[model samples]
Target: MNKLLLTLGFVLIPLLVIFALFMTNSVETQITLMCVALVTAIIIGFKAEAFKYDYTTFLFFLYLASFLGILCLIQFLFHVL
Candidate 1:
């Protein structure tokens, strides 16, 4: 179940981004959806250790999530004020 959810999360991340881009016109809504997906990915990455995944891979995911999260914050700020 964990592996399945992890796999589904990875798949859904991109799908959520695409959906946010094409389906939503509001910048805030798009950013909100993206942040939600990124947070989910981060959670799954943290859980990967139980499945014996590599530490380096988890760090990489963490790095990517942080970077994207920062970008989302900036975008939100710009969109808002």
Candidate 2:
């Protein structure tokens, strides 16, 4: 169902990023997965748009990317410190 896919898309992005971080010890891999998750979430949200000028889709991507970025930055800082 569309709703399920939409929900999965919402959930999987962060999950994948975390998984990438845990599975790979490389910052590059984590960043790559974060970007991939952001793009995939954007595409999925766009496709699942059920309303005009759906701002929720934009917010979803924004929040996801921001969260991922913050997580990666924290990890990097900890690594450097």
| Clashes per candidate, residues 3 or more apart or on different chains | 0, 0
Q: Compared with the true structure, what per-residue lDDT tens digits does model 1 show for residues 1-81?
A: 777877877898889877876788787888788888877877775665433656676676677677667766776687779
Best by lDDT: 2
Clashing pairs in 1: none
Which model scores highest in TM-score? 2
What is the clash tally of candidate 2?
0
Candidate 2, which ten residues in sequence have the lowest lDDT sum? 48-57
> In candidate 2, what are the lDDT values of residues 1-81, reduced to their tens digit?
768778988798768877888988888887888888878877777677723376776775787678888988997887789
Quote each prediction's TM-score. 0.64, 0.79
Report every candidate's CA lDDT.
0.74, 0.78
